[model samples]
Target: DRVRIFSRRLTDVTDSIPEMVDYAKTKVKASEFLIEGEVIALGEGGKPVPFQDLMRRFRRVHGVEDMVEKIPLRLYLFDVLQCDGKTLIDLPYTERWEILASLAPTESLAPRIMTRDPKVVNDFMQAALKEGHEGLMAKSLTSDYAPGARGKKWFKIKPSDRLDVVIVAADWGSGRRVGWLSNYHLAVRDDTTGEYLVVGKTFKGLTDAEFDMITKRLQELKIRESKWTVHVKPEIVVEVAHNEIQKSPRYKSGFALRFARIAKFRDDKTPEEADTIQRLRKLYEKQFENKGRLLKEVP
Candidate 1:
């Protein structure tokens, strides 16, 4: 009877049906059902727009009719979770897809192709990239759909430039964040040495709630402390976005992250599985060494 969108939880975004929401609801032929998909704002040339453009409309708390017209929304639905009064939990993914395709019209389905050829896969990836999509999802046909769980059956193949590092320590903040663990000390794992080495620190890219949550978490994992800094067990892994990598003797890793900021806390990964320092070194060589030499030659 009601249309819903599920990310980690059932979202509260569904209230009265707006233009796009109504459109989505109409696409579902089932009286009672759930579908999983990505919501994207279509830009010029029918390319999926960047997140910044979508955020403008997403933040609307009132009077969204104008915004809906300004930035039209599209739901790229891929999976069905329920139909009528029955749950499709135990069904194989291929069967679920067949069910969804039968119920929903062509407009609600994600663009997909069936083939195992490497050349065909490459060509599809190129086309997706051309359309400004992040990447493609490759799901095993036989695997059962597991809600909110990351499994080996589905793979999101996207461009990777960010590095995952664990938080080693944090400084108790000042002013507005006075009691919170504000600045996070990030580290990368040394696989050969079996140690986590400090690479850099960042206080950027966290919400106030995130700061409060991390403070409580780090305090529980606290191992040692100084006047301003509290060292913790290498437990919290964070993905960091940086401008580039540079050599540094400031830490045992001999590499540092430049203009680093927190992308997000990687709750999905453990410290042991966090990215290695060797990867940072390789990235530095690949992205910077030639550019550095070229800069010197410019003089």
Candidate 2:
């Protein structure tokens, strides 16, 4: 009895009818149900297409059948809230899992199972990391499914790999960072030459307290001013994390950081002890090699 159904990713109305009708026949007797799943497009060799490519498939409505054939999908379902004439909101997660497990089809049309077991979850998380995924998500088994709630029941674990580097210069801040210098030009030491190589710049992850403290400290250490960047004494050490590394001409080191964000300020570390440019290059290469092996094992 689905009077209306809407999906952002799904386009094949004919293919979806049987599945929806079957779910309606078996899972619902009086009340309606709303289900959600991630519809991911697959690449030429059955790999997941990039998010941008998925966006293209999501926009076509008149040529939906052609779009479905050109860009296939893999649906990953996680939760269910309503079934039949009863609301499952009051039920514990275990009860919902039992019902879901029993009713869920196991053929090509079924959604992959998601679990909360620490060991199993950890394994999936590690695999995702090795496959270059953003991060892992952990959910409490006892928690109820609350739509649109950013509760403590769910937690996201991102890779905390960071490089401690020295700050060479600062940029004038605007708006909130006006007057005081806030954004930093970071660099890594060159072990052989004892020189610093400009690697990246970042202005994120600073708390209000940290912003005030850093601005005051930078003002004291400012030696000279340049057209775009302000020269400062190499005294502050900051740790940053990034998704990947890429070669760039902007930095003298021949490489630039990508998606870098501040982890913390290393008050205990000196500029002499900061990570070297060579070491950062080695780490990036190692991660790339490890990711290659992970993609082969996923299928």
Candidate 3:
């Protein structure tokens, strides 16, 4: 069933250039179809531009025409939400994918491949990484499109360079951060023993507003407090970035992060969903293996 394809602009739902939306509308040969996809800004080298660069495009309202010329945007259509006057939300994703392929330009749509082989999947992941994609999303063919919902049926597999840890304790701020939590003690789960082991501490990469909000939230979950540190129940999950994992005798799991810093708060994730000590061990081992020898000296 073929119909006119018309894409509606969603400024609030996604951070995309308005010009890109207008361009999509112009490319629609059909007048009564709706497709869902991500809008990405492309660089001169035909690779994705940095996200901050795309944000710059979104903020410019006065000289949008010039900005659009400098930073081009592309849409990768993935699903069909509507066709003619009928809604396709109830249909399974595999069916909607077929409809999207039939209507959208082949060059504009993301490729869909079905496979169960892990080796093939690893090859695809490497290819996507080489092409500068964050990662690839794995979806169940039988799943339905759940709008505004995060479901386990979809998985995002990326490079194992980041870890999501939970905040177990925090220290009272001293200088500019006075009256707020300054240092956060992060922990990863020890699945075998069912315990959360403190790995490292960080107070970086958070805005003033985030510090204030987290202070209040942590206070709510606080169980014990001393003059400087307040021990709280594991509630807040945060993504942490580190140069490498090193052996540590100070903390459990016998590991620590080198130059650890807070990447972002994982509000969508819970403490139980945080990364595990086993995963950390695996990453540490992989790092050494990549270097062709084990790191005997720990930083």
Candidate 4:
């Protein structure tokens, strides 16, 4: 029996299963379907719920009924890949939408339609940023569904507010950084010239657990050793937050990143796909002009 149903991340449901069951009964056909959505927690005034609360829901395999009463969730559906015995992967996004829209009722349990219009997408991204969402995803309407494939068919536009860079080299930990592979040197690619240039470094954002996991992975990928640095295969991509960019002679590109902090490790991204030096130059220009305006306003 190939029944179709929608599934969301455990954290997204604000109501119990009984309530969702009732909602689903009215909204969907009695057939079996598997729908995917994100489960987020909501805060006061209809704000997105915290990740921690969502984690609790994920850990609860038993007592779901009781847990639902305690921890509510919000589901944001994005796609309908399969329905009954038919595969929606061969269908264009527009066709998929027709089936989904006709079948699924847009209520508290409904998922929002993701689009590719840059201007409209940008506006929605800004709203997501203000609402504390990590960022937005852009999918091409002509692309077929490719499960487990990191294809360009679905392009993610994460707030351009941060850079995902590769760890090219790392220095030995010292003092507090001792016993761990800290003090990283990050780099970005030159898409036009096929080169990598150092942009910044940081030793933050890794928990003890993360430290252990990354250290083990880094050691496995180690290629060469230097006096103060270990040159490893550039296999790790990390998201970084920065105050601004500046021109500098210390790096090959005549530029450097300032006040950089680790945001996250991007295991999904490849080193070759890291941001380019040209992109950095553009970002630096905007950051520099913004700083000048701030300085002028200061007393």
lDDT of 4: 0.67
lDDT of 4 at 207: 84
Q: Over the full model, what C-alpha lDDT does candidate 3 score relative to the true structure?
A: 0.75
> Candidates 1 and 2: which is better by lDDT?
1
* TM per prediction: 0.56, 0.56, 0.55, 0.49
Worst lDDT 10-window in candidate 1: 290-299
Candidate with more favorable, higher TM-score: 1 or 4: 1
Clashing residue pairs for model 1 = none
For 1-299, candidate 2 gives per-residue lDDT tens digits of 44443454334443432334455457543455555445555554455544545555555546555665666665544556776666786566667656665555543233223774778877877776655455665666787877666389777777767889988888988897786667888899999998999888888888878878988888788889886568889899999987666667788998777777788999999999999988988986775443332122120
* Residue 219 lDDT in candidate 4: 78
Lowest lDDT block of 10, candidate 4:
290-299
Which candidate wins on lDDT?
A: 1
Higher-lDDT candidate among 2 and 3? 3
Local distance difference test, per candidate? 0.77, 0.67, 0.75, 0.67
Q: Encode model 1's per-residue lDDT on 1-299: one tens digit a residue.
A: 45554333554665322654676567677778777777777655555554545555555667677666666667777888888888996898889999999887887789998798989988998787767676789988888878777599889876546899999999999999898999999999898997999998999999999999999999999999999999999999998887656667798888778778998989999999999988877886764222322211110
Tens digits of per-residue lDDT for model 4 on 67-181? 6655565656566777777878788877876777666766633434465577877788777766656567666777777876739878766533689898888887878767777
Residue 101, candidate 4: Cα error in Å is: 1.0
